[model samples]
Target: MRSCIWKSLTLTIGFSQNLWAQSIHLNEVSSLASGAGIASKPLLLMMGLVALSLLPFVGMMVTSFVKMAVVLSITRQAIGMQQAPPNTVITGLSILLTVYVMHPVGLDVYRKSERYMNYRSSEFFDKANVDMLLKAVQVSEEPIKHFLKTQASEKNLQMFYRIAQKIRKAEDRPSLSMNDYIILVPAFVITELTKAFQIGFMIFLPFMVIDMAVSNILMALGMQMLAPTMISLPFKLLLFVMVDGWHLISKGLVLGYPL
Candidate 1:
């Protein structure tokens, strides 16, 4: 009876000790996890703040903002209204139009990144890891890259690719893909600027005609003292308003994007 009691006591003590050890191990793990979570929040927050600061610049570089802004500015110049709409108004309008055109691309990126973004942590900061962030970027960039490609001309892409190859060492050239942003971004910018200039040129023609006609009339009247632009300004404004220039320009710009 004594031996059986001792054996049962020993087994019970061993079981209890094992349970205690496991509990300790679990508590340590939980504490460490919680600590890591706490640490990452501030880092993530800092990075997010930085990103927000740079967001406007990034949007301008990657989206249709370049084309929109350039076209709008040129239109303003064409109207000879340097300060009528104000720089702020032009920039704001471009931003609005850019957002309108790029909304679909943004949605596509969100959908593609949904899997990586959805996590049990309840906050993005808690769930964000290097691997997860990289994966999210990788998935999200596909839509953006596709949009860029659609806007970018093949000739520009090839030209940039050739330039990049020439700039890099032979060994490095193989690592540089045509789809790389270094190649795509400048190419995309060039393409957008080229198209914007073309639109600007067409816009300039009508205004140029007005200026020339006004100058001829002023010369014929022996009133060369009056600047043609000053005389033509009212006529230009009348013409623009009559044809609903703003409406047409906005419509064309917004619709021009492939979505």
Candidate 2:
């Protein structure tokens, strides 16, 4: 009876050991699965971040922000305000102005989107969104067309129109695509550059005269070591401020485009 009891006890111990080993294997499998899930989460998060980063570019292209920002930057640089007023300040101001100018366009887009969404119509959504985009483009196109018409030749316009026609052939209403308007953007940009340079030249004229006069006077008085820039800069700033230069410049820029 003692020998039979010993054999039974040994068999029970063996079974218990097998069960423990099985539990350990299952635990390892669970740990591996959890680790894999954690690893995949980071990849998904990284992809989402990448997509979000592209949102600004998309917004800029879809809005009037691009031209507004570029023109503001050009104006700032032309005035020799290098790093003065800070890039952050300039960018913030430009963004604010852009939003102001684009308020109506944005409202139109929102209204169209909301109408489509309420009706639960995907087809209408596409058409409405495209129409909204075209409206915004129309606003931009007016200024561009005016600039191009002033600067470009008749032949250039004809060439641009031909190219537009070819490119927009797939559209149902090619004229509504504003294909010619799209072609005018680069030409308008060139015209803006020319006009800005002309303005910059005029701005430098008074400063240049002051510099030459101050240098000549100083040299004649044997104060050759004195710098003219120090004197001229203050006068330039004073002249600029006295005439409400910022107001005039801003007004001129706004009026330069057709509403």
The candidate maximizing TM-score is: 1
lDDT of 1 by residue, 120-151 (tens): 44433343433344455556666777888889
lDDT of 2 by residue, 21-139 (tens): 42444233223333233345454344234434544653454344555556566555544467766888767776876666555544543443343223322331133432432333333
Per-model lDDT: 0.72, 0.48
Off by over 4 Å in 2: 1-81, 108-114, 117-184
lDDT of 1: 0.72
Please report, as a residue range, the 10-residue window in candidate 2 with the lowest summed lDDT.
6-15
For model 1, the stretches where C-alpha displacement exceeds 4 angstroms are 1-50, 120-129
> Which residue pairs in model 2 clash with each other?
none
On lDDT, the leading prediction is 1
What TM-score does model 2 achieve against the real structure?
A: 0.51
Report residue 121 deviation for candidate 2 (angstroms).
10
